[model samples]
Target: KQDSVVEDISAGCGVINFKVNRKLLVQEDVKFGLTSELFNTLKRGTTLVEYSSPNIAKKFHAGHLRSTIIGNFIANLKQSLGNNVIRMNYLGDWGMQFGLLGAGFGQFGCQEKLKQNPLQHLFEVYVQVNKEAEHNEDMKQAARDFFRQLEQHESEAVSLWQQFREITVDEYQHIYKRLGVHFDIYSGESFHQDQAQEVVQQLQSQGLLKTSEKGTGVVDLSPAGDMSSVCTVLRSDGTTLYITRDLAAAIDRKAKYHFDEMIYVTDKSQENHFHQLFHILLAMGHSWADRCKHVPFGLVRGMKTRSGEVVFLEDVLDEARARMLHNMSQSKTTKEMDNTEDTAEKVGISALIVQDFKGPLLSDYTFDWDRMLQAQGDTGVFLQYTHARLCRSVLLKITKLYLAGGVSIFALCDLYSYDEVLYQSAQDLQPKHLVNFLLKLCHLIASAHRELPVKGSSQVVAQVGRLILVDSLAFNIQLYTVPLCTKHKLI
Candidate 1:
């Protein structure tokens, strides 16, 4: 007799039926305070969120995963509250790095290996080639020759690099989608190569350009021609430096999107790079330079597997899924589970995401499996199980009320459970939602850490009485209590 949709999200006067229209059965819009307001106040128009800019044909590292997930979360949060959030994949698709990567890829690359395991193959070839190129004169000379060829518009190398770039992007796009990510723009450094020269010309026109002894072009920010006040735009060999492309890319984004705000998510090391880039932009009279922000986070260490090596992102996700399914095998609810694959995928990602999100963004930490999988503590499993319990608990209470003189029953565990979930989501609450969340989470932690003494263990009558009392109290306590949270935890 049971089916998909719940009887009603809000109370209904009409008879409940499975075939009822969704619009008729539920509220058209959900209500929450300030979530809508905060998002709207941040942006005047569409906001650009640039993330996961891993090098084309390079392995997407753990740090890249952090930036991708965090940026997407920010974007989703903004969009949900009603803003035109534009997700952009700003790939590191140009510069001398690519010149090196392209050169290395060409001399020692394999098409069959690349097609089968593209990222691993690319990394393997690049690393071996780079190592050899470092000490061996011939390899270094060949790499330089190949890069020079690419610069000169040699059709073979350029075409090969383009193909590698295209294939890698396609592969990453699929992977990102699996992780619930999609980018509206796939802009690259290569896209701004032509535009970079125009930026250089503009800098020179503003008397911002200075020449170095090596005949390279740089910007003079200091009174003297020291390196501190200036950044190298064009290398001594006439090649563009990394910041050169970045400056140009910023200008390009401004021109194209005219974004009200643009955020760059990367590691904390890039603070200086971004500072210089933004300063140069503001100095160049781009008034919208203030709209740019760099949200840098700490390093993630010990992101490895049983093999005792740095794990690939794909491998880690596979492990998460496997571990989650193994956990599911022992779960009492799994036998009643409707969609095993979908549930496994969701729970696996939740496990991974909650680990990162459970801590502060600025604190460096090593990744661990045992810590993230805890069920009796403040883990995703705990949160999810609590949610499921709330569904059942609320139904139980309503049923009890109906049997008790067909009158109202007091709201108990449901409110506490609601507050717990709300706290995790950063919903507005009494006496500072964040503080309440931390307090409640602390209460839950205390309960978990506590040891209980059994009363009347030998007497059967007393044992049964104590069991009933404890069970009743547990139902009520679980309904109102929150979980443990640290001062550093954000959302």
Candidate 2:
């Protein structure tokens, strides 16, 4: 029997290799540019992705890095598959922590220090107040009073909280710009605080709200219904808890966006929180809760600098850029490029993204600057290097081939596997598959570049070589255009 797709099948060394018809592969590549077919196969719909929800009045920590990049990748992937994506940053703006900060500011804050360095000043105030509150009864009462004033919408307390929020957001925008990340909405726990009361009322009306002996509002979640597993919704003081606000936010989002799906990206520590959230939503008769998902990732241990453990995300970014610049300076092939700092920054970010994405999302990994910044091996620096080398060596020839209306059969074979990886990535919501695929493609293209020299080849052979290079370049360009690689600035 003859196969149209598989040109030849041979067995070797405990493996069977099936060689695809190159001409057909090139024809497909020419017709669809490697991903159009897969994109067409997907069902387009609106997707709401909530991620990078850092608390206000605090520095963006390295722990948030995983959520930021992972959520960005999911949004980018969904959008690439023709889904309408809403990127949301659900900020932690309202909480008891704010109460302490507010009281601390009143006692020990400096306006000049705040103006000079907002996050650092706010952080110091928070730390100092927490330490004092440990032994000082007056400090504890002050924090409670300040929080009560905020809850009551007192003008003075409201004004101070708003200023802190504004300053934090302004500073965060600058850092987000550096990371190439953005959000369509900057919502916070405060946004749904009022709605949370309505949620409690609904829970009461539905007979789902139960009062514990301690007078806190909770929902029984255990199978035995013996109050073994409970989800708390309100405090004894009647203030809404985190889950209460989350329920309100979910209901509000469904009414507003009518999305086909919603994804929450957070650390694995909050797995039970989201679990109870969705379960309670289902119990509340919001069937749309079925479409909601929680994508949890593991921690990045040892994410620190020589100075100390990293508290601010800016510190990590600066460290990566500085380390990358130093490494570049040591390289003999390093040439002066325009915006060298910008290039280094982008590449350093790529290193961070790739290191985070190269393994299973639920598996914690240690961060090593020396390992990730290496110019060789399975690092992002190597990925960028490959792209640069291909661009410098064969971009002009690839352009000529494109103008001639010819597709590269030489590289189509390597690209054929991309669609499978992409489809798997979308289905599983895992980026490791895509990362590994790109790394393998880089190795294959590098090998092809070495073996297939175009400088002295026949016209047909040279055209084939150029086409191969162009396919790789085109694939990379398409990748970077998407938010995933775009954030990394791989091109």
Candidate 3:
């Protein structure tokens, strides 16, 4: 009886024979494992994610791009799992780099250009000043003096630095909008400067801090009695280093948010830095330091735009949007939409993200735009294209089904096939699993749409069954894609 029922309603009058539970096909949350019971029992808590920590007055490079999207993905995943996630962009807004930039700005910086093109002008000034400082001791001294003034909170120095930070942040926020990323907090090394000194003092009081032969303050992190590894918290001149600032920031975040876990997303190059950081915190008697994690990713080579090698995050976003638009214009399958530009932007970004995420996070890969944006294959464009195709197919049939009342849409689908794939995708956080499943679902959907007679005077019950299937597919697809889009405010 079950076999006969499957054959009767299967696509193309028994060409695709499969069985499905009617109730399971209609209940999306159950199919996706996001039921209320699961949430009620899950142990969810606060999580702070720090990512895309771009340096102030510097280019928001491709490395930061990786951090931004990866962090966003992590944040989205944690939230979906019921965790209270805080998205943070820890800007590198302090240190000697600022001293160089400050001194350079005083010499070659223009108020007009700085106001007009803040990052570019500042980068140019930094480059120029760096070259001059290498040959001129006077220029070097000026950098030191300017940095000293900044540390001392001199009005003029602080005001200039503040302007640079504000302008750069404003620019980054706009660009992050294009990539669909946002931050709850924009904390930085500067925010921890005072706290860093206090941390040093605390370490001193606790007898954990010791002076090295070079006059720098070091913390012993070795497991053995002999010091195998030491973290340098203070330089010879009493200035706090990057790790010191990080320690202060971590402590501050824990105290303020009381986050159960904190994750730092950066490149693999800084793996050692984080190792030392967590070690120092543990040595300082902060047991909660073990909850901290550093999620390191690999590099991308040959990412460029028409102008040249990509420098700013804006360039990468623009390049993706522009290339996608061009591809859409050339493709016969491209649909006419009121917001084609916006669609292209989403699709383009989707392609870039999928391409990067297709491999293991720790493996470096050469980026190729053409490969990423291809219409067919395991590319992001393919995912977006499939989604768009499914949307059109379902919407057209849905209108017909609505007109044909009392139809049983849930009856026609082989829900077991799609349900298993969706379940597995959700369980495996790797996006490729979801991607491959989506591709298979799209294939099955395309075949069903072609074979199923939904257009002319179809049985109302059959139409309803098809509608149930399409709605289920839409729900599942959005379950994965919506988070990416929502991060960028696309939905």
Candidate maximizing lDDT = 2
Each prediction's whole-model lDDT (CA): 0.64, 0.84, 0.77
> In candidate 2, residue 405 scores what lDDT?
39
TM for every model, in the order presented, reads: 0.73, 0.91, 0.86
Worst 10-residue lDDT window for candidate 3 reads 403-412
* lDDT, candidate 2, 435-460, per-residue tens: 88877877876776677765556787
True-vs-predicted CA distance for residue 350, candidate 3, Å: 1.2
The residue pairs found clashing in candidate 2 are none
TM-score, cand. 2 vs. native = 0.91
Off by over 4 Å in 1: 1-40, 213-215, 222-228, 331-341, 389-491
Q: Report the lDDT tens digits of candidate 1 across residue range 231-312.
A: 7888777667778888998888888888887888888888889988888999899878898888787798888766656635
Please give the clash total of every predicted structure, in order. Answer: 6, 0, 5
* Model 2 score (lDDT): 0.84
lDDT of 3 by residue, 1-491 (tens): 45522434456854764554545544432342344564444334998989989998666677888898888877776776677999999999999888899998878999999888777888888889999999999989989999999999999999999999999999888888878788999999999999999999999999989888899999988788355678889999999999999999999999999999888999899999999899889888899999898888889999889999887787788889999999999999776788988888888888888887777677788989999999888777777766665566556545633433332344334434443443343344344555555556666666777777455527766666666566566656667565444643222
Candidate 2 lDDT score at position 188: 90
Cα RMSD (angstroms) for every candidate in the order listed? 12.3, 3.9, 6.5
Better of 1 and 2 by lDDT: 2
